[model samples]
Target chain A: MFFFALIVKPLVLFILGLNKRGQNNLPVKGPAIIAANHNSHLDTLVLMSLFPIAKIHKIRPVAAADYFLRSGFMKWFSTYCIDIIPLDRKNRVNKKALFAECHKALDNGDILILFPEGSRGTPEQMSQLKKGVFHLVKDRDDTQVTPVVLRGLGRALPKGTALFVPFNCDVVIGQPVPAQEKADDFIKLLASRYDNLFQYCVTHQEPEQ
Target chain B: MFNIPQNSLYTMLLVLLFLCIGTITRLVLKAKFPQKDYTELRQRIQSWWWMVAILFFALVFSKTTAIILFALISYLALKEFLSIVPSRPADRRVIFWAYIIIPFQYYWAATSWYGMFIIFIPVYVFLFLPMRMVLVGETKGFIRSAGVLHWAIMLTVFCLSHIAYLLVLEDKNPQAGPIGLVLFLVIMTQLNDVSQYIWGKLFGKHKIIPKVSPNKTWEGFLGGLVTITILSGLVAPILTPLGFAYGLLAGLIISSSGFIGDVVISSVKRDLQIKDSGSLIPGHGGILDRMDSMMFTAPLFFHFLYYVKY
Candidate 1:
């Protein structure tokens, strides 16, 4: 975490030119979920850098176990450097056990960063969101779910490519959505909130002078 | 201690005085008018202080530092341009190569390699980038991508580099040196912008180009032209080898070309259908918004001085 704050945060902000908006929406204390769109590997790094370095230990990005923990080195880096909460993607029988760690993190007042897209998608294009976020927040009406929209990172370091290009990225955080009672209602509310925040990333046609 | 040129020192002091005045005026405005929101004005003044400090150190430190600073500015300007402009996914590698050209271009300017600095972008990279894009094999939007990328390089890198080149020019004026020339051009160009805004607010009636830039007017244009021409004439003898008459001509070139540059960028924003390029600066918008005039003034003023004196 010390190494990340000292090195990775500055390096990511400098290279990516992270232009953030509505940062005040980020919950100062957690038991909260920061749900953002997934586009690139740099997404996790960029999101982590947004929080204060002192709370680095309290922020945990919920990543896929198989993908992030594929190799020995990646597992070490993902667990230690990024401090991610690895959730098993293939565990179908024990869904309840899969979310035990997430529930524990929330109970302990830690912020969990979740990309509801489940996996990386095409550059600059939003994909179908997974229902895992709804599962995590359902029945926990007190836990705040903040919707964040990330644009231009896919172009910078999109999936299936190792070459990094410097592109200016926008991070738009929206007001937290109240947890809905039904799973479908919660998912729909989250998606709608995302759509609203995503509008901030779109370049509107300004009236000509 | 670095031997600061006499004219450069005097110019720095003048800039400091202006900044102090701006601070006082901002404070007075806030205190006197409690209801009025002075956020934009305050942010503009704050950005000005930062810009002046950065430019001051870059000029005072050494020639290498100044060149590096301009190179970084070119990088930022180009980044902001590329970010706003429509680009194809296939041209991603092409964009990477475009950024790679910045350092090499600045290197030529820093080493005083006039041969490469002049033609490297226009001749070599102009031809080279299209070929690299062709190799990517995405024929769709090929021409548009090539045109956009090439133009971005020209405006951001090729044009802005002239200011850095000014610092490396042979010291024809022993009293002022190259730093003075830089200060003179930058100050005159920015002064023309501020003077035009003030004059336009006071007496501007006739719209110059309503379609592109509605705010610009004939009154403001003429006011800025006269103000900059006289100011340039006054400062040229102190800063450059040009006499008062030649200085007026230099002023004429900078003021007119600066106006054209401002409108040209305005046209670009209109075409793109965006208000401010990016929110990099607090009140200024982006590096491109601030540098639109410099894009024209730097090259024109540099060449005019080179032709007349060097």
Candidate 2:
């Protein structure tokens, strides 16, 4: 974890010229959730590289079972290296298994990263956050949610292309929103917060003074 | 094709020692202040290794290889600068031409054509780029656009090419080898920056230009200039044909000129509200951030050598 995060990932991000902003907003020790906007394949790499070892090892991003767990290599990668929770995004998305997986990770006191957009979207402002993420935390009061917005992944490595253009990946991390009572209300809060972060990213083109 | 100069080898050994000391210091500091994050410190140490490795290879390789290496650096730096600045879609064609000019600029240096190499970016590209932009028929912010593109080319290509053009310097003076001159200029300029940072942290009280670069201070600037000048004064004779006095003058000139370049680039990034130029180099911001000081030092050092030793 230390070698990959500290040595390898930074070298890769340095080559691609990824700038991770507002990473300090992430909990140093996890047992929390990182709910971010997803658009590019670079998202997972961005998230993995942003945090140092302690928090990084604890982060298990919720990846689509179909895409991430399908291939044998990806299956081995997801299970061993990335340590993602396999989420069936197809018809009848094993909601129970998803909940059990989230609860299992949270119960073990690990941070779970989720893309509430569910599937990758252009996320011009933000795609509508799905209900599963809201449900994952709504019933649980212990898990803290950090609303994150990842900008520039589209430009860095767009959906259709493998070639990566050099650009800054701005991570706008909002204040941790404690779980709300109603799932819809919680989803709304997350969506609006994600939207606000997106706005801040676009308007604050200049770097922090 | 080359034998590493005594000065360059000495400089490399010194750099290795400095990096080892720096890494040890960071590790000790991290142990002392376990709560504070040393990610930047760690990045700095790693980048120094990368820089040293690159310098070793660039010099060890033939002069042609060194010229090509710098040309690639110029391309990367130019691209990074252009990507950050805003431009219309219509400027795309002219921007393509901007990239094309990079190889041509290096070609002149490779061929040792000093006349065209010196004037290509400033004279030819300066007029041609704006004319090309005008040919695109986009008049909105034309002056601003043209000025930005030309400025980018001049700094990223023209000034940086001077480092590669060091290869051609030996054509005039056998005593001033390309490897030694390059090593001296680069190591001296970088040391100037590092010394400024150290001085600023240790003795910096009053900000020099708080509005443009809040981190810069009077103590840092003056202390760094003295340190770099003295160091360069000692090292220059081993690398070039200059006596001690001229070496000191070169040191002072490089430090003072390097400061201007640093401040100017800082202002640009500040205007753009960016902390670093890019995230290409760890601890350093971008290729621009790493090369900004060179923009001032390379040309000055090149011309100074051309007039005196060459």
State the DockQ of every prediction. 0.38, 0.13
Candidate 2: what is its chain A TM-score?
0.85
lDDT of 1 by residue, B108-144 (tens): 9999999999999999999999999989998988898
- Per-residue error at A142 for model 2, in Å? 12
* Stretches of candidate 1 exceeding 4 Å from the true structure: A202-209
lDDT of 1 by residue, A135-179 (tens): 877768669889998888887888899889887777899999876
| Lowest-sum lDDT 10-residue window in model 1 chain B | B272-281
**lDDT for each candidate structure:** 0.88, 0.78
Clashing pairs in 2: A207-B273, B278-B285
Chain B TM-score list for all models:
0.99, 0.94
TM-score of 2: 0.71
Candidate of highest lDDT:
1
Q: Backbone clashes per model, in order?
A: 0, 2
User: Candidate 2 lDDT, tens digit per residue, B123-168?
Assistant: 8888888888878897877887788888888899999999998876
